[model samples]
Target chain A: MTKDDLLIIDALQYVNWNRELFEQAREGGVDAIHVTIAYWENFAEVEANIAQWDRHFEECGDLVMPVRQAEDIDAARAAGKTGIILGFQNCSPVEDDLHNVERLHAMGVRIMQLSYNNQSLLATGCYEDDDAGITRFGREAIKEMNRVGMLIDMSHSAEKSTLQAIEYSQRPIAITHANPSSFHEALRNKSDTVLRALAESGGMLGVSLYPFHLRGGSDCKREDFCQMVYDAANLMGVERVGIGSDLCQNWGYETLEWMRSGKWTFRPDYGEGSAANADWPRQPDWFRDSRDFMNIAEGLRETGFSDEEVRKVMGLNWLEFFRDAFAPASSVGA
Target chain B: MTKDDLLIIDALQYVNWNRELFEQAREGGVDAIHVTIAYWENFAEVEANIAQWDRHFEECGDLVMPVRQAEDIDAARAAGKTGIILGFQNCSPVEDDLHNVERLHAMGVRIMQLSYNNQSLLATGCYEDDDAGITRFGREAIKEMNRVGMLIDMSHSAEKSTLQAIEYSQRPIAITHANPSSFHEALRNKSDTVLRALAESGGMLGVSLYPFHLRGGSDCKREDFCQMVYDAANLMGVERVGIGSDLCQNWGYETLEWMRSGKWTFRPDYGEGSAANADWPRQPDWFRDSRDFMNIAEGLRETGFSDEEVRKVMGLNWLEFFRDAFAPASSVGA
Candidate 1:
């Protein structure tokens, strides 16, 4: 396929969106984006978020289209618009009901994390003192999500919870934005065990390009990042690796704080951040925004990935995953 | 202890309250009883049920007292009143939050079934086509329940789910109302595997006197039941078996229909009932009401059980269990 034919999908991006950001994504040839629209919002709050996105689609329809199904991605590519697949970075939107999983899926929410950076109802977050795996509701929620076709995202879930989710979920789950802890020993990073099990379960790992997760922080060399991807692909097949970028662009420090704390604690929790550096970490120079995605593709080539493999890792892999992820379960007697 | 002084705690009883029922329990020398306060009710609905119980307690202050802990049974015994321990027959009261476990525990809900007669968020009921065991939320609910001191009742859960609950719970669970399937082959009855596991895990089996679960239906003889209890205690230790007379009193067939088909289906689901037999089954002649509890004690003696064994089966075993069931988990390094 030609460069134009290459389906470039970012598995995750939580940007404070505007026409300019949409234009940047369009310029970057981002066919679709799994955009995080909810973090710690309850059901009504998420509905309000969706209403705001409804306005975005109304005003910026030329730049972005809502992707409710896998075929919608193809439609967005054909129409030259970035397909926005709305997602939640935590289980709060579902509140305490598996019925909400179906409700949110109907509202065009295509993906959701079992936990963020704390102990959620469904699963333990990466920052919890104990990883209790998936809770009773989490299992039911996973089943409901699987039936209704919302991807289970384990990006910020604890290791035990994430691993259990990968095992328990009928459809393959997604680590929408995380790097391997073997490459960089960050608490947010996944282990080799999780990575391999993720691949074995036909799951995808959206390698984060956000500097906090990268080995060298904001100065992470493009070559080194690409090399890490190459090694990760070697551990987990190339068909499972893709860029999530974790692009948290144009959001204030307060927004980051909300993402971390979200009424869970009385005091501030820096999450993977420390008191010494308690703001959103700076992005790597190479992948500061959606427009710079091709830098990874070029670096992948430099790191000796084949053109077919580069195409697969960039977006084709996620496209394949989405085809399964968004289809309603084959109900036995429905 | 003398026969008059023996602690008599029935593990479960769901009687539509009246002064006569309390008087009958008092006549039977019953000290404490685990009374199901909710079944298939949501959080608010359960609160309403609790309010009704509060009114019952206010009106019948001379005959009944609420049991909030193991010690409350003794308090009721001293006051010559029947201790009413509040419990739920399903996890519906908790809705979808583990936080609710603590909240409900605070409200004096000491026991909850993970499921009833259909698929619950926590577990599959005995009547489901498939038993997928405990869900993700079930796991967390177990941990939270363990910490908050709620006795998990698996009386109506499916086989796999019951076994899993026995294995997964840190504290011992109770099959608060059911017989051994080896004795009757009823859908609600526990298997040899589940019974052995329950006993091994320090769990209790409140041998059900509900006719629907008995071997010979309403004609079930006192001797046959006492023999079954003896056999059951032989299988699952003597201390693990007690009476949980699932008495449905002071209600019409409409209440039975509600119990069997609570908004779960558009059509009537008879549950353990067949098409020809859709009303509530009659209790055995020996166990028609709380006043008949001594009939069981006498039958157990006829079945060659010692006075101490009868006392243990009647209440002391549950007393030993309650000592552990209602104490909030010791917080380490808090």
Candidate 2:
């Protein structure tokens, strides 16, 4: 498969979107990327994030193009440009408003997680002890999201809720950017039972490149990341598997610290109107120095994948999944 | 008994304090009252609440005096003044900072419920389903509150954390105002086990006059309110039973809807502000046609409580409980 056939679609990234990063994606052979703009934010905060993206579109139009249709992937690729598919690491920005899903969908958020790493109004986060599956609000959120034809991501969701969501959704769901817990046991990793159940519903499980899911946390080589995918493939077929690097290419350690605190900044009462405070947007330790996109591709190659398999794993699988999952605007249920 | 012997002390009331209320309390023989100046607010909001109290002190100095000690009650009675004990319906104003508790205590906030009717950073409110109990921050808050001699009220606390707090606190706590679950098995009502356990700490339970508690969800009269207290007295003995009327006097249905929506106003993100909007502060349905303080005393008299029993039930029992529970000025425990 040529570079064109191997459309490298990264399902997750939380970069500080500026002209430099947008230009970098164009150079990175990133055929398309799902950029996360929300985590632990409320609806207003998410709106601010979308507004920032609006500025990005106007400023960086030459390099970055927003993807509203699945067909836009080829248009972006043919134009030698990278398509930006907006995603959220958490549904917090929407908070208790299920109605905001359609509004956010209009603003270019195509994918949403039910929760972050703790209990939200909808679903319990993976970190919470009570994994009682989808809450009443969570079920409603799924219905709204399904109706809107937005992809439901269960990457950081509780196991029970993850399975419930895969079953509850009429359309195929996604465990976007996660590793099989059967390969490496971690709080963020998904179990085979859930992975298989997700696959059974024509859902997908995109293997994450986060080092924590590998054999060694931060010390992991790129081959470890590829092997995690092989393990998920062994349990669930290759068509149901994909690559979601969970890449925060330009972000750093300070980001994790901001994520850990319930408040993004010490003094930020609301995240609206500000691009977040200076205290927030701090780089976390993990992303202080990061592996570039080329290294990630080379790493997958070293893990015994053929060029055909690598093509699908890199981006083709996600492209096909997105086309199948998201219905046309007129066919949208909501 | 004389009006002085009645010694009526309202353990909790969040009324819009004005010269009229102060003059009314003086007329009704309210010796000392725990007036809530904070709820669903932050330090800045609490500061504003205190500022309003300062205005009240200036506007109605002849009839009102700040009550810092049990001695203040006696002093106010002799001085022919109504002693005002500042209180908080919720500790959200303090947010997650423990040091803020000291600032609030110094500002004359003597009583605080861990949360309103839902989860805050410190603890879960009664309306929240998960009973994870006192959070790490909540434990720290209790210790700080104990250190400052502020009364730790569990009137709206989750049962799991309430019991945990009862065991954790070095000082005795108060339910301040709540009904027994035996009377009304609602989330708002405490179970008989917690009620009995509260009295075991040499603590007190202030029976609320809210109709939701007395005879289940149905409306109740003054006699039904007396019967609920008698039931508590049967289980907890009369000494541990007192009145915490939760008199939201002059607070209207708009305020109730605000409280119900978890925002102070109908608009989005209406929280984070302490003062009710100028258009707010209308009287609710329960208080619109309710009897006065004399009517409550007469209701107890009609319910077979003797004049001597009336003195304890009205206020003396609460004062003695607070005197023993609250640490002296010098040796507040850490």
Candidate 3:
């Protein structure tokens, strides 16, 4: 197949989405992107966000379609339009109610993070001093998410919480966007132990391209990035590795501040980025936006990945993962 | 001391609060009542409820005063005004945020139930099929409640959840409006195991006078009610027992429906009352409104309780519990 013929998916992105961004995603030939519809927003607040997304779909129907099931991604590919798969970077959308899991899923949310960068009712975030692991509500939430066909994304969760979530969840979970700490020592990255456990539990890890998660931050070379992914694939099986750009496009510094602190604190919480660099970190030159997915595939090919392996890592893996992950347990029957 | 000299506290009441009800409380000589300010409300919704109460405070300043600290109960007793100590019948007001515990506390909410009449993130309510005990969110909520001096009330929660809450909580919890299941075997009532655990843990049990929870429903005799309290006091020390008089006054059938089923189901939830008697049950003739505290006190005296023992069960015990319960752990250091 030609480079243009392969499916492309980014498992995570929280962009200031508009028709322009939709057009850029189309230019990237992206089949689907799991866009965050929630962070610290509660159920009502998230519903308002969904209303805005509804408006986006209404206004930009020509360029993008909403992804309800995995097949919609294929339809988006067929239609030459990007599928917007709704997700949450935190469980705040459901708040304390497990019933909201099914509700939000009904509202087109297919992925959810148990915690953002703090201690939540479900699990501990990476920033917490103590990782209490998956909480009692967290256990119930996992079951509800499993039952309702929502993917559990532990991208920003603490290690113990993430591990416990993988163990407790009946269905395979996803670390939708984060790299291996072995490749880079950021607290947001997973350990080798987590990576191995995740793969063994039939989970997937979306290697992040966010600057802070990279070995050389904003200056990381594409060869180095491809090599890191290759090492992770060797460690976590090629089928379990894919791209989740963790891209935050068309957003100002205030959005970054909100992500870092939410309403959890009055003071600044310059998360992963330092106080001196208390803003959205710059993407490296090679992969600045949605248009740069080809560079990643080209770099992977140059790094000695066969075309089949390149397709799997680029989008096919996530497509397959979503195909299995986004069906209600009763409908799928295991 | 005369009966009027004794401090009178009703542990739980949810009146469609108005100047009339406040005047009735004055007539009943109720020094303080832990008023239900929330059932299934979310943070914003509960804030609206609080705002309404603020208006009440402004308009009916002659009839009532908001109780912030426990000593405010005494101030109300001294000033001849009923103190409104706000509480919740469910944890919905706090939703998923632990920080809201302190925020709600600042807004004058002092007691909160982990669940109302269905399974909540914190605990299983009385009406659920299975009792999962305290949830992960429940544990964290317990800690935050302890820290913030919010009384954890397990009134409508299932047995196992109640027992687990008492076990996990560092400070004492209250069953603010429940009777012993031994006295009358309703699902809403506490088991002997729960009673023993509660008393052993320095907790309090507010013997509910709600007709459905009472032995003979609306026909329940005042003597029988006092006898039940006397028996409870004998079984568990008198010091741990007090009146909760679950007086839900001045609301329509819709309010009862809201209490039984708050967006949890598309269908109706009759709660403790059956579909045949699905409407709010009538209060026993002897205890129709807040103006019936003397009847309870007199019945307790006639049920072989001495004046001191009557005072203890009527409100003195609750006064002591509130005195200890409403101060933050940092201030109380207990």
Best by lDDT: 3
| Chain A TM-scores of all predicted models | 0.97, 0.87, 0.98
Number of the predicted model whose DockQ against the real structure is largest: 2
Could you tell me how far off, in angstroms, the CA of residue A308 lies in candidate 3 after the best superposition? 7.8
Give the alpha carbon lDDT tens digit for every residue of B1-334 in model 1: 3448577888888888888888988998899989988777878889999999899899999999999889899899999999999999998787655678888998889999998877666777787655657765677789888888889999999998899898999999999999999889889998899999999999999988889888899999999999999999899889988888887788888888877766444356778888899988888988888887888898998998999999999999999888888887773210
When sorted by lDDT, best at the front, the candidate numbers are: 3, 1, 2
DockQ order of candidates, top first: 2, 3, 1
When just chain B is superposed on the true chain B, each candidate scores a TM-score of 0.97, 0.87, 0.98
The DockQ value obtained for model 1 is: 0.06
User: Which docking band does candidate 2 fall into?
Assistant: incorrect
Q: After superposing the true interface residues, what Cα RMSD does each candidate give? A: 8.8, 6.5, 7.8
Query: Residue-wise lDDT of candidate 3 within A1-334, one digit each (tens)?
Result: 4548679999998899887888888888888999998888888889999999899989999999999999999998988899999999998877655688888999999999998877666777787655657765577788889998999999999898889989999999999999999889998999999999999999999989999999999999999999999999999999999999999999989888888767645457788887788888889999999998999999999998899999999999999999989988998897
| lDDT of candidate 2 over B1-334, digit per residue (tens) | 5564678877877676777777777877888888877655556767887898888888888989898777788899889998988888787667544568887888777888887766654566676545556654567778777777888898887787688878888788888888898877767789988988888877789887655555633346567777777778878878888877776667765675555454322243222122444333323234322235666777677788788777888888988877755564356333
lDDT string for model 1 (A231-251, tens) is 999999999998898899898
lDDT of 2 at B15: 72
Better of 1 and 3 by DockQ: 3
- State the displacement of the C-alpha of residue B145, model 1, in Å, after optimal TM-score superposition: 5.4
